[model samples]
Target: MAIGWLSILKAVPWTDVVSNAPKVADGAKKLWETVARKKAPTGTSASATSDTSSPAGQEARIAELAGELDRLQQEMLASSQLLKTLAEQNAQLVRRVYWQSRLLLVVGLIAVAGLTLVLLR
Candidate 1:
C-alpha cells in the first residue's frame, strides 16, 4: 500500500505544482473577493415598483422571487469562501512537500558521502 502511494506521489510533478500554487491561491482569493463584494439584488424589481395597482398575488410572487435571488447570492458567497480556503490549504501543502523533498535529497547525499568515506578507509 505504501509503495503504491509512493509511486503515485512520484508521478506528480512537484516543481510544476509548487510553481503554480501561488497562482492558484491568488485566483481563488480574487474569485472570493469578487463574489463577496457583489451587491445582492434589492428585492424591488421595476415591475413590482411601477405596478402598485397590480393584484396582491403578483406582488407576493415578485417578493418570493427576490427572496430566492438573495438566498442564491448568499450560497454563492459561501461556496467562494470554501473554495478560497481549500486553495490556500493546497498551496501550503505544496510548499511543505517541496521543502521536505529538498531535505530528503540533502540527507540522501550525506548518507552516500558517509558510506563512500567508510568504504575508502
Candidate 2:
C-alpha cells in the first residue's frame, strides 16, 4: 500500500506542470504589482535624499560594492573546493565498500563450502 502511494506521487505529469507554470508566474507578478502600487510612497523631496548621485558618493558606493563582490567570490571558491573534496571522499568510500563486499562474498562462499564438506563426512 505504501509502495503504491509512493509510485503515484512519483508519477507527476511534468509536461502539464511546465505548461501551467507561466500562467501561475503571470498571476503572481500581477498580484505583486498591484500590492506594490498600493504601498508606494506618496511624496518625494530632494532634502530627504542622500548624495549618492555625487562623484564622491558614487566612488564610495563602487568601492563598497567591489569589496562585497570580492568577499562573495572568495566564499564561492572555498565552497566549491569543499564540494570537490567531499565528492572525492564519497567516491573513495564507494570503492572501499565495493571491495569489502567482494571480500565478504568470497569468505562467505568458502565458509559455506567447508560446512558442506563437514556435513557430508
Candidate 3:
C-alpha cells in the first residue's frame, strides 16, 4: 500500500507544482484581501428608501432581505480566508516535498558511489 502511494508521489511533477505554489498562494491572498476590504451592503436598498409609502410589511421584508445579503457576504469572506490558509499550507507542503526529493537523490548518488568504490577495491 505504501509503495503504491510512493509511486504516485514520484510520478507527480514536483518542480512544476513548486514553481506554481507561490502564484496560487498569492492569488488566494489577493482574493481574501479583496473580499475583506469591501464594505457590507447597507440594509437600506435604493428601492426601499425611494418608496417611503411602502407598507410596513414590505419594509420589514426588505430589511430581512438586506440582513440575508449581509450574512451571505460574511460567509463569502470566511470562505475566502479559509481558501487563503489552505493555499499557504499547500505551498509549504510542496516546498518540503521538493527539498526532500532533492535530498533523496543526493543520498542515492552517494550510496551508489560508495558501493562502486567498495566493489572496485
Candidate 4:
C-alpha cells in the first residue's frame, strides 16, 4: 500500500499557505535588500534612476519629442515643395531647349536653300 506522492501534495493546507505567502515574500524582499544595500556602491544607484519615471519629467520628454516631430514634418513639407518647384522649372527649361533647337534647324535649312538658289543662277 504505497502512499502516493500526489495524495501527499494534495493534502497540503493550500489556503493557509497562500494566505502567508505575501508576508513571506515581504520578509524575503527586505532580507535581500539589506544584503544588497551593504554590497552596492554609493551614488551609482542614484544616477541609474532616470527622471522620466516622474509625471512632470515624462510630460517634458513627450513635449520635446512632439516638437521634434513637428520640426521634421515641416522640414519634409518644405523640401517636397522645393522639389516640386525645381521639377516645374526643369520641365519649362526642357521645353524651351526643345523649341530653340527646332527653330535653329528651320533657320539653317532656309539658309542652305537660299545659298543653293544663288549658286544655281
**Which candidate number would show the highest lDDT if scored against the true structure?**
3
Q: Whole-model Cα lDDT per candidate? A: 0.73, 0.61, 0.74, 0.61
Native-referenced Cα lDDT, model 3 = 0.74
Q: Of models 1 and 2, which has the larger lDDT?
A: 1
Model 3, runs deviating above 4 Å: 6-54
TM-score of each: 0.58, 0.57, 0.58, 0.56
Candidate scoring better on TM-score of 2 and 3:
3
lDDT of 1: 0.73
Residue 5, model 1: lDDT of 91
Superior candidate under TM-score, 3 versus 4 = 3
Better of 1 and 4 by TM-score: 1
Off by over 4 Å in 2: 1-49
Please, what are the lDDT tens digits per residue for candidate 2 over residues 3-121?
A: 97764444444454566557556655654554454433424356323655788866876786686677666556655655565565556556655665677689999999999999999
Query: Poorest 10 consecutive residues of model 2 by lDDT?
Result: 39-48
> Which ten contiguous residues of candidate 4 have the minimum total lDDT?
39-48
Model 3, 38-97: lDDT tens digits are: 667656677757664568857887787787788667767767766776776677767777
